[model samples]
Target: MARLTVPLVLFGALIALLLVGRVTSVQAQDIEPRAFSNAPIGVNFLIAGYGYTRGGLAFDSSVPVTDPQLETSSAVLGYARVIDLWGQSGKVDVMVPYSWLSGTAESAGQPIERIVDGFADPRFRLSVNLLGAPALTLEEFRDYKQDLIVGASLQVSAPWGQYDNSRVVNLGTNRWWFKPEIGVSKAVGPWTFELAGAVTLYTENQDFLNGGTRAQEPLYSLQGHVIRGFRSGVWASLDVTHFTGGRTTINDTLNNDLQRNWRLGGTLALPVDAHNSIKLYASSGVAARTGNNFDLIGIAWQYRWGGGL
Candidate 1:
């Protein structure tokens, strides 16, 4: 009937845009998994990754600490493109990261250590889909299918990376930041569900460290995902995130570091053919009050190509 209801509504909108292309996050109370996705119109993708983290940071007894530790490792690269817009369906992505960090802190008790590497803040994103999706190709997106869809995105963070005014712990955070998001997805039978919300905005860092001046406020997030699909292409996911406020200030004083966090993660994707794929992930910090109490692991490799262009 109607060609089997348009391939079951384009296969439930392609499994809700493959669970919103697996949302991604970095720092500032991060947690991500499929932010809302659906693809077709041109297509292209590439990704590479490695990550490791272990942390503990709680500093706010006015200004001075007693015990803190952090360890980090990273390497990441990404690219994506899919477009149409006007008729809807759009995408764009970029990410670049490189880091290595080591830390230990204590003030009056004495014991300070620091090690650093380079590159960190670099990200860019833009997404659109605004309801049920459209703009197809790749042979009309192989027939199309959907149940619900909605999307919006904007992400940016670029301070170039590797900054030092004399270090306090630097990888980068010299300034600039952005985030604005909204997402929704749904499917059934083979499962898919998602939700998203975000707010992160900051800019101000006038040297800070020896020169001093920094500021922050605004960071609020919420995320969720549940995905499942199998047979050949494979998929799996279960994730959660929550975040609240960001408080900081330097020369003007005030460094409450306010943040209420919660996170939990999981992901698995495997294909290795028809354009290749492989992904695995992990996340932790079930709850935290200040910030940074981490555990993470990652792996990634993905490739795909322009469909018709």
Candidate 2:
């Protein structure tokens, strides 16, 4: 029985880690499952993935002349470690992404095309369980069962990507952005429900196109997911998200690029063994008032190691 409990606890922790890999930042609306999870401390995970996206960029009427289209492909790599903080379960992770993009747009009644390839801004996240989850060892975790969990996280994007002062559109945002989020999850039987809310704040870009300062208002986002677990360490999720209010200004001139978007997506995870898992997901914009109207598909591989410390 003791030996059986160890493998069960380890498998549960790995499933939670694989769910985290599904929440990539490749799109504006990130889909997350099991945001407030209970896993034993001192576990580490490594993830690698690829994503493809095709969409149209919606521009303000003051700048563009016609329809614009964009297609992008990216490679993602990340590392995560679970620890104990203040007697509670906590995690810290980092992600780096590189992308190649090509697009066409019409300006001044003429069609223009451009291609760019470079690294995008990297992201770091720290999350802590605030309620209903405590730091536990492997043996102690064996008897634990999840109920209601509340968690909080802070995610930051560093402005270290490829940026060109001369280009109007580049792979990088050229500014720092961060989001503070709170999440709650409840489990009943083999199903879990999760909801999370966040607001994204951006810093000024001093080197905007043609040497102008660029600023944006705060963006508000809400996300929800319904997840179901199956036999053999398999899980699936249905997810949705909405975002609004990110009006941009360049040199004090307001742009009509406020975001009011809704998206829907789903994810599936299959476990090959105790240490390896695969994730597949796809999402599309159901409604878009501004920004990009795109569809994205991604697949990831996760390898986990380490046990309780």
How many clashes show up per model?
16, 0
Off by over 4 Å in 1: 10-12, 19-31, 36-38, 42-136, 143-176, 179-201, 205-214, 217-226, 230-236, 240-247, 254-260, 265-285, 291-309
Estimate TM-scores for all models.
0.32, 0.90
Q: Which residue pairs clash within candidate 2?
A: none
Q: Backbone clash tally for model 1?
A: 16
TM-score for candidate 1, residues paired by index = 0.32
Could you give candidate 1's per-residue lDDT for residues 1-309 as a string of tens digits? 987765544443343335333333345555566665666777777777777777753111112344567777788777777788889888888878787878886644678787888777788888898888887877786667667888898888888888887666677777888888888888787787888889988887888777888788887888888988764456788988888777777788877667788888888876654555667777787886754567777777766677663
In model 1, where is the ten-residue run with the lowest total lDDT? 57-66
Which portions of model 2 show Cα errors greater than 4 Å?
1-19, 56-66, 107-110
What is the C-alpha lDDT profile of model 2 across 145-185, one tens digit per residue? Answer: 88999999999888887888776656677888898999999
